[model samples]
Target: MNIIVISSPQQELNEASIIGALFEHGLEVFHLRKPTYSIYDTEALIQAIEPKFRDRVVLHHHYALAEKYNLRGIHFTGHYVKSHSDQLTNWYDKAKQQAMTVSGSKHQLKELETLEVPYNYVFLSPVFDSISKAGYKSNFADLKSIEKYKSATQLIALGGISLDKIDQVKRMGFDGAAVLGTVWEKPAQAIAVFMELKAAWEKKDQIF
Candidate 1:
């Protein structure tokens, strides 16, 4: 199972340095999802990361940054999918040709149950109660009952993900897990926590 780490929506002290450490320590995908940051602020942060590791970064906003950097991928939140329907259709073909990882977000299983656009992967959230956002609880009554959707697009379990919960996520038929609070809740411990999560995720294949 893949271990995807998402950036904290709120900025962190020594954020860029911490991110650089993450990249150096085998973090494959880092979603840069700052919702309220300005273009200049985002650009400045990007510039701080090592150029070689920038390709592992995915932009959730200021997509134009992709044009300026060899970033890994671009993701569309559910809102983006709904608001920019035309843009998604036109961009997918081009994105495929460039070997870019394009993803989308969905809150409901019904959305993935349909023949949605082929995102490299899409995040299905609130698999467990969210630790990043207070009171943002899991939406499904029984996550164990979730059958994997049939489609080329991979499904990633998001919200409330942590090292111990990785097994539950994989058992739920998710392609992977995306984490936020587990890492950012204690910024000083981000790398330590990430290593533990990554190890757990990699070990899942040894099980059923």
Candidate 2:
């Protein structure tokens, strides 16, 4: 299972170095999501990362930066897609032209039926409540129901994907998981926490 790490919305101490460290420690994908940051600020953050590792990064805002930095991909939040439905198709075409991965976020299963573009992976969020955001609860009563959607796009379970929840996430038939709070809630131990989650995900075949 892929472990896609979502960046903290705000800056953290030694952020760039820690990001570089994450790459060194075998983190495959890192989502850079800073809603309030200007394009220039986002550019600088990307520049701060080592040149070689930049390709593994994905932007949640200022998506053009993905092309500028030759980053991995661009992400579409559920809100952004709703607000820019007309432009969504054009953006997907553009992203494909650039040979970059494309991912989208969805809060409701109904939204999946309306998808015009097949995202490389789509985040089905609040799968088990949100550890990062208080009161953001899982929207589904039976996650197993999502198995039918797997043929449409790779489904990534976002929200509340902590070290202990990996087993539950797997059982729900999710393709992978997008983690936020498990690492950001304790920045100093981000790398350690990520390692544990990665190990748990990798060993699920043995443990289950």
Candidate 3:
């Protein structure tokens, strides 16, 4: 089970330092998602991170930075894909040519069926009640349906993921788990939570 961490939407104190620590502690993927950031602001944030770990970073916006920084991949939001339908093929082809992983977010299971291009993985969110978004309860109830879809493409469980919920995610047949609010809400204890989650994930793997 791959453990992915998403950056807080807004910058937090010592954000770069925390990111560097996450890499040192074996965080495999870090998604840089800042919806309101200008291109320059995004670039500055990336620059702030240690150069050695840049390749492990994924961009939610600023697709061009994937090449500029030799990033791990680029993640497309559902809205972005829908708005740029005509350019999806080109983006996919370019990402492949650059040998970068491609991923996206899908809120609905039905949307996964409609994806024309292959993604290395896709985030299926609100699997449980959201930690970051108020009042955003889990809408996922069909584990059987999720398992059925997992066979076609790698599905990563996102939203409200925590150490305790890791086992539940694995039992549901998800390929990976993504963390956001659980880490950011208490950045001071982020490392401890991350280590706990990682240990739980590895222990689960050992059993199954």
lDDT agreement with native, every candidate: 0.84, 0.88, 0.88
How well is each residue in 1-208 modelled by candidate 3, as lDDT tens digits?
Answer: 3899999999899999999999999998999999999999999999998899998999999889888998988988888888988987888898899999889998888887877689889999989899999999887865544676765568999999988899888888888899999889999988888888888777745544
Off by over 4 Å in 2: none
In candidate 2, residue 34 scores what lDDT? Answer: 92
- Weakest 10 consecutive residues of candidate 3 by summed lDDT: 142-151
The alpha-carbon deviation from the true structure for residue 46 of candidate 1, after best TM-score superposition, in angstroms, is 1.2
Pick the winner on TM-score between candidates 1 and 2.
2
Candidate 2 all-Cα RMSD: 1.5
How close is every model to the real structure, measured as TM-score?
A: 0.92, 0.95, 0.95
**Model 2 Cα shift for residue 73 (angstroms):** 0.6
Model 1 per-residue lDDT at 156: 87
| Number of the candidate with higher lDDT, 1 or 3 | 3
Candidate 3 residues lying further than 4 Å off, grouped into runs, are: 142-145, 205-208
What TM-score would candidate 1 get against the native? Answer: 0.92
Task: Name every residue pair that clashes in candidate 1.
Answer: none
